[model samples]
Target chain A: MNKLLKNSLRFVLFLLVQTLILNQIEIGFGIQLMIYPLFIMLLSFDTGVLSLLAISFTLGICIDAFSNTFGLHTSSLLVFSFLRPVIFKLFDSREGYDLLLEPTVLNMGNGWFIKSFGSLLLIHHFWFYLLEMFKLNDMGYVLQKTVYSLPLSFFLCVLLQYLFVNKQYTK
Target chain B: MRNFIAFIKHFRNVLIFALLQGIALSLYFTFVQFPRTQYLTTAASIQGSILEARNGITKHFNLSKNNVRLQKENIELLEELPKSFIKLEGKLVKIDDTLHRQQYEYIPGIIINSTHSKRENYFTLNIGSSQGIKRGMGVFSTNGIVGVIHNTSEHYAVIKTCLTKKLNTSIMLEKTGQQGFLEWDGVNARKGSMTGVSNDLKIKKWAKVVTRGGGGIFPRGLPVGKISRVEVVEGESLWDLTMIFAEDFRKVQNVYIIKNLLLDEQRDIEKQTDYEDQE
Candidate 1:
């Protein structure tokens, strides 16, 4: 499949899965599952930060329209995409990244993926809850929500890669 | 000029990030405080139709449960009909009186989407301006009050339910007659709090709370919930009361949009007093 067409199709699929499926499941303690950030992470390595911001904005707006969170998702997703390159740089292997390989668990080794994605997910989740509650008085609750939701969302994102990403990258 | 161009090329990413972040945060805050448009909300045309299609499939998951609740409401209405009662006192004859008039109208709608876990929860209704639904109209199920209509498109409307942060509907305790504004703490869906009522009044557990109708949005005596706990506010004379909502927001599919016929008249009269005070 053409890369552009495949990525666009993934975009729509992630949007639907996040808005229709994940947003509806309300496990208490403010634990919201967000795997759409994985969609931003899965984009091609050479995609420019400007274009990445634009794509995240569009994806975030679509999800926002469905879930009625206004621009809450958009703001958080922009932060995710903006920090993606910085995190990639920090987690760069001794040989550096191969431009041909996408950022998936199969393409990147387990340790590299875990350390980078884990920190990224933490920042993303914390920023989301902070802006969401938006009250300094509710700092404890916001931290609690971020901590509880981070593991669930991260696990879901990792599981999603195993289920859908092309295993041919391993070879 | 060359240095500025180089600067722009160097820090374009950060600048653009800031610009987009500013936009998103502004949009979020403005919409949260005051919903001005329906374009980005589910009330928009494309989103509304898509969610309606989705609801077409998932609405059936709770079909039997919703039907039972509807059936129970129907039986209650059926029992109240004149035909259900015997003419036990013909001497106290029924007569048409010139003094009374209908002041409220109800339009039925079904909720297509709802969320209780968010800081401010809004439900999308199947009815909208096409069905005479407008912003500020009160929405409620047969069991209890829901929320006010926040935004409306041609065929869809969004209700800012009681689960939201600032859904301050005026309410009064059934037994004590003390009134307060309703509030939600964004943590629990089944529980809510009321503010502004002083601590001097004795409030019993399980006492009923109903709408006071002071704002003319909801009619008087609509069921709100029952008081479960009452604690005095720290260093204040007000009572921090907690109540369990009567309506289960998660399963509320069917609802009625209230249309107050005398709202315009009431507003006009109230405006006169404000105008007088201004002068």
Candidate 2:
């Protein structure tokens, strides 16, 4: 399969699986597995910032449609896409600018990838939940939701990246 | 001109990204209109069905407790029946005894799905259109008002619960008759705030609150909750009051759908007023 076609197919599959399957699994106590961000994180490093933003927007809107909230997911996804490049720069290795390489635990090393992915996942979850409770008067509630959702989303994203990215196993 | 052309050529991707983002935002705004859109609601229906099925299993243990509560409510209603009869004595007595029908009826239903986690939460009932359930009807548990019917399918109906931020129930102080709008702040399921109350009204703690019937959705004098706390916002002429809901929505099993016969006429009058305003 062509590289672009393959990536597009993966993006659609991830979105469908996330919306139709993963979102349904609420293990009680506010822990929901958020795997939608994996699509944006798996794109090749050389992918243009514009394309990344567009893809993120599309993914977010699709999820938002299913969730029945207007602009909340789209705005959060836009923020995540906007910050992805900065996150990459912060965790960049000494041997930078590898055009052939994508974001994978094998290529980027598990330690750096986990840290970067965790930060981005936190950002996405925070914005998403905050936008969701837009009219809430209590900041404490917002903080609580963000704190509870971040780790769950981070773990899910990392696990998905490791499992499907065909990367070398790293402890 | 050359620099401008070169810039456009070099950063075309950024422009495309911005365009796509704009399109996405527009689409979000367009399709994500709340309380509407079949696509989103269909998903909610599916989720509601699954949750309802799960709740049905878990709630089996609570059946005995629910029965006890229902019995208590039945006793209370029987006690109130004489008072209602006394109140309606002059108006209803003059009518032919056999010709007059019951003014109001309550149909018992079970909440199959409920959510307190989201800002705009909705629940599903086991009774629906087939059971004479329709959109715009009111729902209440034995304790107090629960919510209003949002949409209805064949055997199920979606109810936007009182806990939802999008819900606003017209309410008043039972003692003072001061009207206000009750809305949930999307944080607590057990509590919400009553806005639009004038500062002049002496809103004491634990004052009885009930539906004002101003909205035409709920009948007059349905129990809402008691005023837990009252605060006069600084520099504002309105008092913000918190209410501890009378009904425990978390354990809500059976609910009564309040079908008001006068709803269509009221709605038509309101629509005419809106039309006049537009003109």
Candidate 3:
């Protein structure tokens, strides 16, 4: 499959799965499972930041439209995509990244993937739930939601990568 | 000019990020209460139809429960029929019917999609303007009050349900006649608070609450909920009251959209009063 076509298909798939399936799962204790940030994290490292931001914004808006959340999802996804490149650079290895590699766990080892994706997902969830409940007195609830939802979302995103991505190690 | 161009080039990514972020956040805040259009909401054709199709599949999951509620309502109506009552033989009584006129009509609708946990939640209904549904019309189930029509397209409509903030429905306690506006605290779906009731009056536990019908959106005396707790406010002379909603919004599928036949008359009179006051 062409790279562009494959990614577009993945984009539509992620949107449907997130809105239709994951959004409906109402586990108590604010344990929301968000996998769309994985879509931002899995984009190739060389992808332009502007395009990345646009994609996240579009994806977020689509999800928001479905869920009646206005633009809350778009704002949080935009922040996550905007910081993706900076975080990647911060955690970049000394030997530098290879051009042929993608950001999947197969290409980038588990340790690097875990650190970068973990921090990005943390920021995304915190921003999402914080702005969602935007009351000062409810800061405790926001933190509680972020803390509980992060591990489940992180696990699901990792599980998604394993199930979907073929492990063809280049190095 | 070259130095300025260099500066622009230096922070191009940041500028674009800020621009996009501004647009997104503006959209978020602007439409949080009133939706400017139906395009970005589930009332849009594509999303509405998709949800309707999904609802077609999942609706049956709650079929048995809905059936029981419907059956119970049917029994209540059945028991109210003239055939069920016996007439006494003593005297003939003439009842006058010309003093009253019907003012409200109900249109049936199915909830295609809904969310209970969001700070501002809206439910999508399968019926819309095509079925004579309009903005500001009241929506309620057989059990209790639901919401008001927020927006509509040709074939679908979105309801700003009781779960949201600022969608106040004027309600009153059944026993004491203490009226207050309904408000949701963004906490539990089953629970909501009523504000503006004076604290001097004693309220009973589990007293019924019903719609007041002052706004003309809903008819008089629709069942809303039962008061579970009532407490006095600290600084203000008002009651801090919470009620358990009668309708479980999460499982609610069938609802009726209220159409006020005399709404235009009411609005026209009110508008003239406002105009006269201005003059």
DockQ of each: 0.83, 0.30, 0.69
Native-vs-model 1 lDDT? 0.92
Q: Write the per-residue lDDT of candidate 3 for residues A130-156, one digit (tens) a residue.
A: 788878899988888889899999888
Once model 3 is optimally superposed onto the true structure by TM-score, how far is the C-alpha of residue B213 displaced, in angstroms?
A: 1.4
TM-scores for all candidates: the values are 0.97, 0.73, 0.96
Q: Each prediction's interface RMSD?
A: 0.8, 4.6, 1.3
Predicted candidate 3 versus true structure: per-residue lDDT over B85-198, tens digit per residue: 787864765577788998999898999898876778799999889899898999999989999999899999999999987666899988778899999877788988899999
lDDT, candidate 2, B163-190, per-residue tens: 7764667899999999988798776678
Tell me the tens digit of each residue's lDDT in model 1 across B1-279. 999999998999999999999989999999987888899999998889988998999999999999999999999999998789898787776679779999999999999999989898999999899889988999999989999999999999999999998796899998778999999989999999988999887889999999999999999999999999989899999999999999989889999999999999999999999999999
Off by over 4 Å in 1: A168-171, B90-93
After TM-score superposition, the amount by which residue B226's alpha carbon in candidate 1 deviates from its true location, in angstroms, is: 1.2
lDDT of 2 by residue, A1-171 (tens): 488898878877876676556655545544456777777877878887877887887777766644545456677778777788889998777877476667876677779877887888889887777666654575677778778877777777777766776753334
- DockQ class, candidate 1: high
